[model samples]
Target: MVANTQMDADKVKIMGSKVKVDSIMKVADIEEAEKQKMKRKVDKILAYKPDVFINRQLVYNYPEQLLADAGVMVIEHADFDGMERLAAVLGAEILSTFDDPKSDVLGSCAGIEEIMIGEDKVIKFAGCQRNEACSIVLRGSGNHILDEAERSLHDAICVLVSAVKNHRTIYGGGNAEIRMSLAVHDLANTVEGKQALAIEAFSRALRQ
Candidate 1:
């Protein structure tokens, strides 16, 4: 299951830094209330019986221990974009609250395990229900190379997606740009105003 809520002991909200309670017993009551609130949230999550828990926010030690004890693999602090992509791939819902969780809302995968990629450990989810969705991890010796690689990869993926969606192909090697430049220049010649200069300049820029 994918969740965005922070998995931690709930804190009591007071108006000021120092509050005078009716009795010392009130302090104990407040602490117990916090515990109960956290326990309830944990219980609600466990009721779903998900094989793995993916949280977009932090999973504090207390609740983390409980989830660990339940034999549920916990992945915490996943960014919003990642959670969205993961949920899509897994065919799961992004649930902020586990209350009244739908039976079919959980995502499925063949397995999840920690794997070493370069010097870092990453959790790999295999055999997602949405076979079309996949993740690629890029590694590089330097940040600049990695950034450039990522930009190139993004452009490539966007092109691929556009081609797939439109079922069309175009000429490579700046052929399309040259064609546009030629078309714009042809239009510029027929224009009878100062806008012709702007159009001609744009055409030349495209050619370059």
Candidate 2:
């Protein structure tokens, strides 16, 4: 996966414009210049062999056709947050320029494919380096339900991150709680001050 962070077609066109005599340029010349500029950008991107391309802005048909020919999948108008998450999941560094694309900066995935989810077409990336990439497709009858589902998903992800960082997994059936409560109770008995009472209270709460 490689992303062209600069998705400004107008900027490329501006750079392609030539300053001619009498400040006049033929329409054909301008069009050809733009096409050449787009071709260069596309060629540079294709050289990276990115299985997927995430564009922040709309991609024109010309470049899209080129990518298709190269067997590269593209996701246009991707959100910034999505792109950041993708980079993390792929263990890939985001490069702003193709001037010197190192292997370390390129991301690889086992595969990418488009799948039909209901009436919509969804792109799925598989076997990323992190193996933690996920996509949530929400189906709701109304906007309110979708919004609520999104908020719930965000909260669930936060909890998952916290759990992963802690590197602890406890079994169900309150076994962990019982063990923690007992440990805390024992520690409280060793305390020499009134603070022990607070500790005991916490331990009891855990047991409950």
Best by TM-score: 1
RMSD of 1: 8.7
Worst 10 residues of 1 by lDDT: 7-16
- Residue lDDT tens for model 1, 1-208: 8988977666666765886789989988997888788888998999999878899999987788888899987899997887888999999999988779676999898988899998888888898988657789898899999999999999999998898899868789999999999999999999979999999999999999
lDDT of 1: 0.88
**Candidate with maximal lDDT:** 1
- Model 2 over residues 26-135: C-alpha lDDT tens digits? 65666667777777988888877777777766777888888889987778876777777788778887666777756677777787788998898877778887855667
- Looking at model 1, the pairs that clash are none
Clashing pairs in 2: none
User: Candidate 2: where are CA atoms >4 Å away?
Assistant: 6-25, 137-157, 164-208
Evaluated at residue 161, the lDDT of candidate 2 is 92
* Cα-based TM-score, every candidate: 0.73, 0.61
